[model samples]
Target: MYPHPHALEAVAVLRVAELLREAERERRLPRTSLRRRLAYWLRAWAEKLEAPNSQLGYA
Candidate 1:
């Protein structure tokens, strides 16, 4: 069944509000180390590539 148009609008507004709050939280967080940043990128890459856990290496 389809949702009411107003409900979809409300959901979009809520999501935008949550995203704004998340951005604010990120701005307040401490700077990450180079190694930590590298690990994060590696993890994201592995996920995107659908690589196996064994191939993730030192990350």
Candidate 2:
């Protein structure tokens, strides 16, 4: 069965978010920058899901 496009995008976004958060916690990313990057990625992912043909690229 084919998965819903939005569901797939959501899973992808969540997985990325988890990885980003982990990296941040591990000190791989700067604390102040982490928040900005996370918010950017999350918003881009949501936009991509809502607009399948949009040209936004994932991080």
Candidate 3:
């Protein structure tokens, strides 16, 4: 049996959040620019959410 299309979504979201947080924690992403970086993440996430996925989770 295969996993569902939405199954990996949470993982993706978590990973993105964690990576961004880690970047910020390491001071790689400036505090002043955090909002822009987060906005980019949100757009990417929205794109993934709105994409039409096949059963295999491909576009």
TM-score of each: 0.43, 0.54, 0.50
Ranking by TM-score: 2, 3, 1
Q: Residues 1-59, candidate 3, lDDT per residue (tens digit)?
A: 98776768745765776687678679897666766778478657745754787343534
Worst lDDT 10-window in candidate 1? 50-59
lDDT for position 8 in model 2: 69
Deviation in Å, model 3, residue 46 alpha carbon: 14
Which regions of candidate 1 deviate over 4 angstroms? 28-59
| Residues 1-59, model 2: lDDT tens digits | 99656566777886776677678679897668768777678866765755756454332
* Overall lDDT per candidate, in order of appearance: 0.49, 0.67, 0.66
* Residues 1-59 of candidate 1: C-alpha lDDT, one tens digit per residue: 99666555445544544554465468754456864575455445444334344342321
Over 4 Å off, model 2: 31-37, 40-59
Number of the top-ranking candidate, with TM-score as the measure: 2
